[model samples]
Target: MPELKTPDSLETQSCQVILSVLYQLNLNHENNVAMSSERRQFILDCLQPSLRQRLISMITYSLNQDLNVTCKLLDYLFDSGIPHLDLITRRFSSFYFPADQVPTVYRLLSRGDPTSLEKLCIGIHLDHSEEGDWEDEEKETICWYSGVKRKEESVSKVLVYNSYFYPTLEKMKKLRHVVLHGVCDNQALSIIGQSCNLLQYLDITGSSDVTDVGIQNLVFPPAIQKAGRVNLVNTRARTNPSMKHICTVLARDTGVDVTGCIILLQFCPRQWI
Candidate 1:
């Protein structure tokens, strides 16, 4: 990492003071305390344009590997009106956001460059509150690429959970792996099946809206590229006749793993021989 250049005179002093507070808070984050939004903004307002960018870069790159710090920094960036979209998408692996805050994320992306969106690994943070329970105590949030590389050639994996609106998949043509929790519906599954040509690994949990038709589209399609694994658990997709046949064909013909689709486990023995 290159050394950070300090601003001249009072600006340098102000930056040092803010950075000291930020670092102290980061180190003691176990106390679950955070800098107030107003305080962060005040410090930002005091810095020069170049200094602002450097400060943002310092927070992001300095704690990219520390989930707690990264989450806190990301939240600050989101609230700061300068998401630095290009920097985050290119350098960070995952992001978590409350369901209501999702639109802010999209808006930030819209205002910035979209060139790096295709190559970076992206994941959605499922708000645990969607289930009608939210704890008063602060909980640790995690981004999907917590353990993966920061920079990669293409976005190979995505995790979505309890999302209200389906994502537009037109830009994810190179997607290879996906994990959907309570977010896969007939329309969304159909869109993914048709557009994501390189898709292979998929895990869908708690998708009550998916049915035989949606499940089938995942295999036989204009964009069919026989998936390596299809782990379907706790879904309401029917486990009868036609769906069984498709699973059988995918397993026996294309070698796709459908054994994890618990509903079809019985049929696997009969047809997969």
Candidate 2:
């Protein structure tokens, strides 16, 4: 019988072969279940940081096309602690809060480690069905993380909406752009007007609670008036009377510009009139 010998680099070669086969199988019209599982475990076990990062990038690119792959890649990243979280944040534009990973993501944010997050976008909706209703504790956790006090030095922009209006505005004095999609009472508007003076762009859209009285009360400080661009679209102040008030205020103001106004008076419900 002829002697059988395995090459010294057989293990490394096997790993590469498995990875190549898995890559091809993933691209095929139909994936091989057993082979895919074996390759996935093998790739994960290899524990190469570069490989992990590449996988995350590939998975994120395919997120809209293949959620399953995105989820799997997220699982791998979370498990492996890919070290460079910047890729994860960049890849996941809309925060991906899988039920199992929500706590981990929350912890990462709440830890007050600035480097943990590169970008943050928070969306709050009155309709709970759109996303899970944040518990008071979770809300507070999110508020704490989203607050400007905790942001990493690398963070440049923070886009927030919904229940986020008050807490986020109150703390994020460095914010450059803000969009208030839901209702904002007089108090909320005042808080923003007073705190976020550095804001450059602001959009108050679909806010039924913001009436002409509330709009008139929004006295931007000199700094904000000089630098900010304000947009009031589809709000209670969309009526001719309310718009006149807004125009009068803008005209009187020095620092702000309300040049592009999309005031739809016909859409203003009778209740507002």
Q: Which candidate is the best by TM-score?
A: 1
- Residue-by-residue lDDT tens digits, candidate 2, 44-161: 6766655665554554443353334444334433332343332223344533332223333333323322222222222223232333343423322212211211112221111222
Candidate 2 residue runs with Cα over 4 Å from true position: 1-168, 220-273
User: Tens-digit lDDT track for model 1 on 105-214?
Assistant: 44433433232222222233443334433343434232231211122122112223224234434444444545454335455555655666545444444333344445
Candidate 1 regions exceeding 4 Å error are: 1-96, 108-167, 206-208, 222-273
Per-candidate RMSD vs. true structure?
Answer: 14.9, 17.2
**Any residue pairs clashing in model 1, and if so which?**
none
Error of 1 at 127 (Å): 7.4
Task: Name the top lDDT candidate.
Answer: 1
| TM-score of candidate 2 on Cα atoms, chains taken together | 0.29
Candidate 2 clashes between residue pairs 3 or more apart in a chain or in different chains: 225-255, 225-256, 226-255
Error of 1 at 123 (Å): 6.0
